[model samples]
Target: MERIKIHFAYDGTDFAGYQVQLEKRTVQLVIEQALAKIHRQDIKVFTSGRTDSGVHAIDQVIHFNTPLTLDCSAWRNALQTLLPIDIQIKHVEKVDESFHARKSAKEKIYRYQIINQREYDLFKRMYEWHVIKPINIDQVKIAAKRIEGTHDFTAFSASKSNVKGDKTRTIHAIDVLEEFGRIVIEVRGDGFLTHMVRIIVGTLVEIGIGRRDQSCIDRAFATLDRQVVGLTAPSHGLYLWKVVY
Candidate 1:
């Protein structure tokens, strides 16, 4: 058997999530089915990470072991023909047998977009979180700066999560930019807990709207309590931007 790495992107509007579910459409399931058809064997995929329901990905990576020997481009194009319109296989390459996508990843970046205007963009409704009220980008940055180091992120993660690791993770950066009536929050971390990025965005949104002070972020980090943070922003606005190895 040979190991191959694949890079892909998908719009997660219809799928349940990246992981396979009992009876729901998923990015992993679709790819696994396509691989099974092409290889004529049971092919399993190991992903860089998981995204929640309605969350999209731009450069998600995965690896699989296959018995067939085929050109890398042929493998990519053939899988694209089998996948749905929302999912696209971007590239394929042969890799060392020990290359595990998730384990080899050094960090992951996720971006959340918010439409900060009165009227929503119809085509972008399913891709962003819309906020009618005005938001102060500077205030969001102030809150963002408070959480930019190795700290326990329990306050910014969903109460019910299956993430297994030390809660203390390093956040390399949290950047907030406003452009074209949209607010973008980019977070890069070594790893993330389930819904952690969305919750961090929600906490910053509260600070931007004057509902919470920037100091509250410090308190939340010090306490490591989930109740200290705000709501988890909707999944639609979140995207797995990239995975760094």
Candidate 2:
């Protein structure tokens, strides 16, 4: 079988999520439908990971096997003609059969956006988490620093997440930056559990607003309890910013 690799981006607002459900609209379902139109058969695709409902992915990677031979450009254009406007085919290429999208990924960067101002901006309503209270950027920075290295992040993930086994993941860096009336939190990590990045943002936001302190991060880790952690941030504000292989 010939393996083809694809790099794609999606708005993720109108769809259910990345993975296909029985009836719900999804990125995978639409892509596969488009592939079916071209290949004249069902084509199974494997993604790096599934994004929750309303979660956006800027560069979601996937790989699929095909029996027919077609150039990279031909595949890209053909898929685009069948896909909806919300999804875009960024790049496509033929890859070695050994390259598995999920297993081969080395890093992923997630971005969460929050509007720190009190008044809400109608234009940014759908894309950002609007925070009415004042946030101390310095406090947010302090908490971000504490969890920069490797640790078992069991406390920072959704308890009901289907992903099981080791909760240990290395966080390469977390940068808290303010720009254009919004606060952006970017986390680079080797891997993430369900709602992992959203949970991290929620924890930091709590500290910035004085509801929690840096100690909570430690307590959550030491106890390995989700109850010690902050609420999971809204899904719309989170984005799978990048994936590195």
Candidate 3:
């Protein structure tokens, strides 16, 4: 069997999420179906990570094994032609059998986008979270620094999650950037817990709007309690920005 790695991006608004579920449209379902058409057999894919419903991806990595052989360019062109318009095949390459997409990933970067004006961008509504009130970008930046470095991220994870084992993860950086009219929070970390980036974004937004203070970060970390954290930002505004191996 030859191991093949694929890189793709998707507009997640139309699908349920990244994972396949019964009676629901999913990214994995569509891609696997397309691959099956080419190979005339079912193909199983291993992804770097799963994104929630309505979450987009700038670059998502996956790998699978197949007996049928094809060159990288042919593989890319073939898959793109079979997949939907919303799902784009970026690159396809043959990789070593030892390489696993999820396990080989050394770091991941996720970005949460927010429009900080009273009126939202009509066209970009599906891609960005709209904040009716103005927020202090300075406060948000200060609060974001607290989340950087290694720590226990128990308070930032989703309240209802299936995560097991250690809750400790090292966050390399949390950068808040003002691009055009959008406030984008890009978080690069060794790994993330379920809804970790969303929860952290919500907490930073609270601090920006004066609903919470910077000390909240310390409190949440000390308490190790989800109740101490802020809201979980909506899925639509989040994007799986990049993955590093």
Candidate achieving the largest lDDT: 3
Off by over 4 Å in 2: none
Candidate 1 lDDT over 1-245, as tens digits, reads 88999999999999999999999998989989998899878788999988989999999999998888888998988999998999978889999977899999999999999998889899999999998878898889988988889998888888877766678889999999876768999999999988889999999998889887888788888898888888899999999999998
* Candidate 2 residue pairs in backbone clash: none
* TM values, all candidates: 0.97, 0.97, 0.98
Model 1 alpha-carbon miss at residue 6, Å: 0.7
Poorly placed runs, candidate 1 (over 4 Å): none
Please write out the lDDT profile of model 3 over residues 1-245, one tens digit for every residue. 89999999999999999999998999999999998999999989999989999999999999999998889999999999999999998888899988999999999999999998888889999999998878999999999999999989999998777799899999999999999878999999999999999999999999999999899899998998998878999999999999999
Computed on alpha carbons, the lDDT of every model, listed in order, comes to: 0.90, 0.91, 0.93
Superposed by TM-score, candidate 2 places the C-alpha of residue 33 at a distance from the truth, in angstroms, of: 0.8
Sorted by lDDT (best first), the order is: 3, 2, 1
Q: Model 3 misses residue 109 by how many Å?
A: 0.6
Each prediction's total of clashing residue pairs, residues at least 3 apart in sequence or on different chains, is 0, 0, 0
Worst 10 residues of 3 by lDDT: 158-167
Q: Name the TM-score of candidate 2.
A: 0.97
Q: Is candidate 2 or candidate 3 better by TM-score?
A: 3
